[model samples]
Target: MTTSKITAEDVAAGVAELVPDAAPVEVVRPLRQGRSHASWVLESSRGWLVGKVLLGPAGTAGLERLAEHRRLWQHGIAVPPVLAFTESCASVADRPLTVFEYVPGVDAEEALPALEPAVVLEVMRATGTALAALHQVPVEGFDDAASGLGTISATWNTVVTSRVEALRDAYRFVDDIPAALVKTGLDLLDSLAEEVSPVARPAVAHLDVYLPNILLDDEGRFRVLLDLEHVRWVDPAMDFVKPAMWMFPDQQSWAEAFADGYRAAGPWPACWSERMAVATGLELLTGVKYWTQVADHAMREDYLRRLRAWVRSDGADHVWSAISSAT
Candidate 1:
């Protein structure tokens, strides 16, 4: 499908600027479901390339994402190395674009749900192994910013607290969410965050580490973890909980497979189960406000329903029990 606001000509021009004698752009197929960038797959005389276009008010992590991918690659993680990148795209409203050699596969999200339950667990087990490998890259702070005089929180605890406070401060306008429910969830996360603080330190984490970003080959093997922009230096438990809550919520097999994968890769931090419970609560509490702001008004009922059941049902303890067995 043709991508809107971008065209074959746009891609050709973008490529020509970098490689004057490069093959003419032949195929340009749009890639959708992206929340941030307008992206495409371009086939040119040169070869196949995946192109990402960023055209908006400048955000912080664009360049850092590319850098972090290389960092992960250097640390023994398999990631697609950027072939060509440019932050200047004056031809299309000052959009910035990066071209990478494409890594092909069906999205794990689309692939896993169709398979048998045991097969799904195996794929996620592999995904968890990959995640643990990436998490082995140590980070110094809560964000992608280089740890510096003013760029980092004094303690990991401060980072966690500051995040909740920031959410509490800014998400006040999300009236669609029940205030009592939000408060209860946040309070749970706050307590959990504190309980885990005694052992917190910076570890590489992908905040949105879930099946959607994972690419799976035809044989049910893990291909690659696609997006790297939300990569952070936080508790590895954050990475653990992210998948549990999003990809296969309350699915014991999913949790079991993931924990086994983590163990398969190597030993992880101690007390991971408890830390993950805290992380789950944090993600659940903040996700209401976060997703509410990001999603359309039509999604209100869905988010509310899922969140309400979880918050009202002793969600954290139940979640911990379901997943902790895997450890």
Candidate 2:
């Protein structure tokens, strides 16, 4: 079935098939669509639940996400529990549909701005603690493509190089991005590729740790971490990319609070500055492409501006600087 044709009744029917014992879905409220998936909040006879439909080409990503969620849940992380899933439900055609227990809290992104400064910092600190716990989870191997939840089987430098090349190739086809900005981005990525070294060990990294994925309780404590589809086995420092780009650039105190909390758990990694810088640069390049494709000109332009500033400022250590000052 086409996405537009999907309705609350259709989703309720699909859920019944996957979870035979589930309570009848009483109400279905659509949530904002993510880059790769569409989600809905469901009120059922049992309780509240969430239904997600994988809309992207990543065929096995739903399975991979389920595995990641279970793994995190096993480690005592605050992730929503998967209730049921089907690879091809009649409601969504060939797309994957998964249901999870609904997390009851407000998204940190929307809630933080209205909160007091100290409260915001406290939330950031808690977020850092959670992320530190996430990076401590053991990963068995570099790549496990057979399970569709794999990291690349290459040295860290090689991974950076490959990502840079992929971004370069992607940027070539875009017409609006300035030629000079592209050169700066490519040159900075090349430099970063040479600077990074192999990580001591692979860890479970939630590469998308921005505010929207973070849910906070009324007390300003982190309640649930959502959207595990981008989970990967990579250098723990790589996880800082999203926050560094989206969270810390303007709010140094929040960055410091987060870094302090992370350091409280363990020694911060060596060469963290360079590693996070590289990760942020890669994200900026990828973000530009993503926003452009989605026809979000404001977001696309914002990414372009950040990319130019970051590359021109000698891989500006703003994120690292804030993090380091907390030490």
Q: Estimate TM-scores for all models.
A: 0.83, 0.87
* TM-score computed on alpha carbons, candidate 2: 0.87
- Candidate 1 global lDDT: 0.67
Residue range 105-194, candidate 2, lDDT tens digits: 888988987898888988888888888888887776443312235455555565566666777787778777777787778778777757
Q: Please report, as a residue range, the 10-residue window in candidate 2 with the lowest summed lDDT.
A: 141-150
Candidate 1 — which residues are off by over 4 angstroms? 1-4, 15-25, 44-46, 113-121, 144-150, 295-315, 318-320
- Residues 119-175, candidate 1, lDDT per residue (tens digit)? 777787888888888877766565522221135554556666777677778668876
Instruction: List lDDT for all candidates, in order.
Output: 0.67, 0.74
Best by TM-score: 2
Best by lDDT: 2
